[model samples]
Target: MPPDLAIAHDFPLASCNTFGIDARARCYVRIASVAELAAALADPRLAGMPRLLLGGGSNIVLTGDFDGVVLHMAIMGREVLGEEGPDGKFTLVRAAAGENWHALVQWTLAQGLGGLENMSLIPGTVGAAPIQNIGAYGVELKDVLHSVTVYELATGRLRSMAASACRFGYRDSVFKHQDGKGLVIVDVTFALPTAWRANLGYAELAQAVAGAGLGAPGPADISEIVVAIRRRKLPDPALIGNAGSFFKNPVVSKTRCAELLAAFPALVHHAQRDGSEKLAAGWLIDQCGWKGRKLGAAGVYPKQALVLVNNGGATGAEVLALARAITDDVRQRYGVTLEPEPVFV
Candidate 1:
């Protein structure tokens, strides 16, 4: 380890993960600078051990204790990359990995940037955003993402990849693939258009904006509405230990969707641009009688069936069990597999 590196042994991680699972790392370190990250990557003590790169810990679940070195990213910085397009119509802004994702969105809105408003109130750090192709309402990170800077752990080299090279898909990207493994994202850059346009394609968001009497809402207006909607529909993780949206909406074939629609007239779904149907996982879980149900200290959020909450003193195993039970139930009933949104460790 570097002389200035801060490393902890057997660090407690009960408060790190949003799910509030009581897990411990055999070794843990906070990487606040690129030099520190490089040093950690080269540490012989940690070289052969399993490594977990943690950012905000909002989009992960610890099923058990981690018997490896946990690198908690804390690097911080942000700057305007420069202006481009006709009449300088586009501005590229970059944010460090440790910066709060929502705080970055708020900062962009404060600067009169509008592309990120629809994704307001989402959790996790900016570094993890593109890894999952994070999306909300009608916009995805890919829509505004310019590039990402990453430290290749295997080679101890820094590199950058443009948005197109990320190979973004629904809730996935190149960062999640084997070839992209051992890469630690340090920061993210977003290309925001100076010309603002409100994305009101999502029905609920459009309805909310309309009801607010804003025929044409600005970035701030849209952000406030999204925050309000999220506050009402999702439990605050600080108040209740839970990760938002425990499962991704399962995409199914159009024929399968139509068959299910005939059998269950009340099914809620969205037609994807590719002619497939995305079924609401929450609705499927709710139909299987999981809402507000409990197994040990883990339970489904009463307000949103999509969320799984830690109902006071929940263990990682308990949470995992509950998730597995719900997954099995949904699969058996609908013939659709439900994939977890969080990274399971």
Candidate 2:
């Protein structure tokens, strides 16, 4: 594809991303290996432009046909980068950003590793995992992220940075910030725990997995539960185009949450670190009566209030406009801001 240029825009990304509805990349390539990807970046036509690093296409919104080249890091290789230790080798997993994330999780569980079981069934790449400090149930990628291999956009310099350099926080890291901006992630490493305790701390996950009777749940048990819950809840992108969880639940002081709760006794909320409370953005959108509401091509997901979907032929602009309306309405009613979870390009 593209004369040995790894694989070119010979394929369209309409179905590649979870947001099933979207424009195509002007020039696209699937670099089967990270070395080939590095070579592509060295090519003059592709050098020195504002580049976008994509993994599984689960967490992005393509507003329009891209003017720049899209580098699909399809490089696939998973290696134990180090020796196992007394507990379990402080195993190192070096994965190209393109590998299906859930598939990898299944692999790790099969091998008896434990750090990523809670993150099982998340719909993005290994590269983007550290970007959002991807979390589910009770575990976060930040808790296990060892390092990230990146290709800097402005200078094409490849560097491996540690977790501290990633500036991790609540659903955020340096890759999520503007400071470490313009870096294209190629590979990532995670230190999964051996003899790990399954994270049954999440209420729903606790009930379901514990009920699965998997005999004192391990990584495999938790993975099955996660996939089951996700399948039951999230609409497959293949069926309907959508980016999961359109907004982040705003973290506010408990005092503020009490004020809102006083206003609406049913205001759904969760406790967080210190005296903070995590308000559900979905609950807010649902409170505004946006659930399952239709507007031409775009509509709020019928099953999950957090997801915005493209009914059939919705353009990115229409989807974004709908999101803005929801945000404005929620803000107006609750006096709290709703932030988007997906990275926009």
Candidate 3:
């Protein structure tokens, strides 16, 4: 027992992960401070073992037991760094890694911050945002993200990275790279505009706001619309045990999109700026007959084909199996490969 290592053995992890898989960690430690993280990393007992940095556990599926140390990020705080820019139009806010993401969004709204409104009701923690570059509606985290602070486990140093250095992509960032291994995100800083503008570009979001009779929707109004749309589309993890969208919208070349569009005139797709086309994964899954389908206790959500839910007591392996079946079917039928959005642990 090292001075810094408050270790717990055989820690139950069913509740930590949103998928509700009953996995256990061989050793677990909840870190609330830099000193605690540093001490635990230095402990000889954990020196050569594998380590998993867990945040809200919203974006992972624990297929089986983890054989190493689970570093549960519990670091928490939020602060306004400043409200200054050229003519004072920007507000800089910082939140610790372990802060609940949706709670942070609500707090920002309460404080009159406007950038994160489009992403309201998203699950996970602040630290996990950068890794996945979480996005919803028409706005992505990279749109307002300024920088992130990470504790490097490999070198035992803390470093800050700008948004560009994050290498953000569709549901990806530098943290997902091998070069970023052992780096634990500690906090995230956002540069939101003091002068707010509603992002109502996404079709469903735009229509929802309009349907509410809001001719000129503000940030708060837009947030409400987004929340309402998400509630209708996604199942609550508490009640249904889902990790939101199960698959990423697969991007294809313009030629491929054209070919598919010719075959199926009703194919749903969005063109990317890069001349690529992002096909609707949910529609593809639905077309492949996976919507509301089940294998064992794992099943596709009835309303959203993109969601895989634990009907009741579904294991990670069972969920993966269901996912694989859908993936294979979608590829076989549509010639498009569906990639899972959640991390398979």
Which candidate comes out best when scored by lDDT?
3
* Local accuracy of candidate 1 as per-residue lDDT tens digits, 1-345: 455667799999987888888899999999888998888877887788888999888889898889999999989988888887789888999999998899999998888787999999898888888898889999999999988998887688889998898999999998899988878899999999888888899999999999999987899999999999999999998899998998999999999999999989999999999999999999999999999999999999999999999988898788889999999999898888999999889
Give me the runs in candidate 3 sitting further than 4 Å from their true place: 1-4
Question: Which is the better candidate, 2 or 3, if ranked by lDDT?
Answer: 3
Model 3 whole-model lDDT (C-alpha atoms): 0.91
Q: Tens digits of per-residue lDDT for model 3 on 1-345?
A: 335568999999988988888899999999998878998888887787788989989999999999999999999999989876798778999999999999999899898889999999999999899999999999999999989998887788899998999999999988899987667999999999988888888888888887899988777888888888889989999899889998999999999999999999999999999999999999999998888989999999999999999999999999999999999998988899999999998
TM-score of each: 0.97, 0.92, 0.97
Ranking by lDDT: 3, 1, 2
Model 1 bad stretches (over 4 Å)? 1-3
lDDT of each: 0.91, 0.80, 0.91
